[model samples]
Target: MRADRLVSLVLLLRRHGRLTAPALARELEVSTRTVLRDIEALSAAGVPVYAERGRHGGFALLPGFRTELTGLNHDEALALLVAGSRRGAQAFGLGSALASAMLKVVDALPESHRDTAAGAVQRLLIDPETDLLSRRQVAEEVPDAIVAEVRRAVFAGHRLRIRYAAVGQSPKWRTVDPVGLVTVRDQGYLLAMRSGADRTYRLSRILAAEELSEPAQRPERVDLDRAWQERSTRFRTGGDQVTVLVRLDPARREELVGTALAVRAEETDADGRLRLEADFQDSRHAVWALWQLATSAEALAPQWLRTALRDRAAAIAASYTSQPES
Candidate 1:
């Protein structure tokens, strides 16, 4: 771990030019004393590190010094190349940085391994634009400025004011303490808190944003994975959840179950159809999901859902039923 920290210190200086002891400690998540010791170690190892004095002083490496650390093996290089082919980085506004990092990784490879790795990458593709059915994967667009401001607030631990357009509601401005950002399936979300209440806002739905001067009231060390999991559990359990009983063709059973929040029970009927009791987010969510199966599925319970599907089918049939032109 000390060796990793030493290498990281060198890389940090190489990237940022100069940094104070406290700044380096903060970035490296260590103590100022540790940073000072690391500096001495690097200099003793002939790394040419130097320090400046006074209140505005900091440590810096000699000009034009860069460590040629090419430690990636062949499989590792290909793994990185395949990961770089994904569009997930674009969702977090790090597309260009990812591209630049990939180039550096490729350039760092040994001359003999570079061509073979580059050629292997061509045989694999990640996150293609269209699937087998030819439906395009549409990625939401969050303005670069908004993403930057939100990111700044998240990293700086500051509060943010955002003009958000919530689904089915008018756009309104709100102040939130941003906990973290998450991008899933090309959609970006700002997981935050408002007046001590957990709030999740879609990045694309943010019309505008401004990082506030006030410090955010949040935990000093945030466990983002835990926070996200807790929020997801609350959302899944708190909403107007509905249990839907549906009869679907055996072949379409997987499709229905795949989209539902959970399957409560499942059994095969005498007619060889699959009968499933599934949990959905709400009535609207259930209707939308079931409708996608078209004639291959039928809602069996909550009489209301049946009526809704019947009414919708009738409306569609009426539209198609034509009278002779006069």
Candidate 2:
């Protein structure tokens, strides 16, 4: 809002319109001569700001005059610098570049403002939970351009061309339509649709990713929530189903179904027996549920479950018999 800069800004807008000298001087709180001098200064700086001598005159940004980094309040600028530093550090191969960008912005600030920015950065702590470099070999310095480009591509619905590597798989180049970006434990994942199915690829796995010119058209009727639900349901189905028939003292039957491993309750018979069914992702997951009521447990329908339990119990007994208490 200082007079000199305000005059320069007013003249910068005049290229698109006309600002009377009086109005320009009033806005800048300066004399008409000073406004003229400011305009000359702008022209000297190679700015396209110009003045027109006419009654219908105001100020405007000339055609194709796009402002960059304009009108950022001090607090907003500081917040941006801080947030970008944190997120960029967490992003694959972009940490150092963000820090460098922040330094450049700080250097451009006024002495006092620069001190404030530097102090803030010193006081700020950016502790990412996951060491992103652990998964891949990246040169220590990360570039800011990668973070900016990836963010632009993710939000614009663009397909990405990536050279990606997976665990136990060779690195390969593939084209994928990115659906969403997932941040987990400080690591970033690009969730995408590949071969018409949802897949997750780690950002670190990507040797390179470039956005395509054309926007990717996602499935017209894709239900994201339903897709997540179906995925979880399928994973549950992949595990073994165990049916537990417990002859609890009728009082304990209710408590038995409340066991941790009980996925759901089938029914309780008249004779105080509870028929419980549960699904386990693995024997460990199932064992966790059954172990909650293992003392009062019975294998009711699936005779194989009973045999497995007996075998485990026999193994325990045999182990004890084979080795006396040392």
Candidate 3:
């Protein structure tokens, strides 16, 4: 570990030319005292690294000192830097580790490729919160303390107790043998077994968590992909979902499908709109999703859903027009 830090320290000074002990500490994620010790170690090893004394002073290597770490080509380095810019690592509490690793990647690159790769990445934007239509994406909030407890249990192979708030239910404490953690579209889930039955809990709904020292009873090896697939299939097939046929504006077809469980059929109509048969969790789910399109979406079949929507619309209209009580 010390060897790796020593190497990273050299790389940092090599790339930045001069950095104060405090600055080096920040980059290396260590204390100023540790940075000073590293400098002494480097100098003792015959590497001419010295410190300047004045306010503008810092530690610097002897002029012409450089390390040739050209393992990744220009394109490869660029790819890595770009991938490192993504935000998913935060979900695992590895955000600081990721930042440190990226710094090393940047510093280790050959000088000629380093500057270009770093500069080119500035032009790319990814996964902006507010999309094109100005609707902001809402990210689920999972407190760091809860996430940390759950993560420790999963990685340590221990039993986990969580205060989970299932939809429409009060938060309750339950113990489970955690299998793994999965994140999709910024939402996190804990795939675990409760009383030997498969259960999945949303991380956002985990109000609190405690990692038990007792070892988890899960199999020594797990294929999380397969586990997640089986759980998802069961959930989808078991739900009391309703299938609704709708005539939707062609422009709003994507928006409608985005919230649907499945698109059963599709065809274009004479009016240049889309006739879509889609499945939603239930009548309420169907109505809520379709209502988002306003006049652009019309329920073609399922008279009950259409009636529900009509009554809902009338109520909303009445609310707006009815006079306020004096």
Instruction: Give lDDT tens digits, candidate 2, residues 1-326.
Output: 45447545654464435566667777667798877677677667666765444567544445665545555554344445545446534454345545555565676677867777777877866554346556443332324455445555666788778888788899998888877655444566666787677777777667777889877656644555566555546655655644444343445555555543434556677876656565445555444544455657665545655676778778877887765767
Residue range 1-326, candidate 1, lDDT tens digits = 89889989999999999999999999999999999999989999999999988988899999988986366543344335435436656766666555666777889777988999999989988788899999999999988788879988998899999999998999999999999888777888899988988889999999999999999987788787888888877887876999989999988888888889889899999989889999999999999999999999999998999999999899989987998578
Which has the greatest TM-score?
1
Candidate models: Cα lDDT each: 0.86, 0.60, 0.85
**All candidates: TM-score:** 0.71, 0.41, 0.68
Task: Give the runs in model 1 whose Cα sits over 4 Å from its true position.
Answer: 1-85, 320-326
The backbone clash count of each candidate, in order, is: 0, 3, 0
Worst 10 residues of 1 by lDDT: 73-82
lDDT score, candidate 1:
0.86
lDDT of 1 at 177: 96
Better of 2 and 3 by TM-score: 3
Off by over 4 Å in 2: 1-60, 69-89, 128-175, 205-326
RMSD of 2: 11.9
Evaluate residue 144 in candidate 3 and report its C-alpha lDDT on the 0 to 100 scale: 73
- Please state the error at residue 7 of candidate 3 in Å: 18
Q: Model 2, residue 247: displacement in angstroms?
A: 23
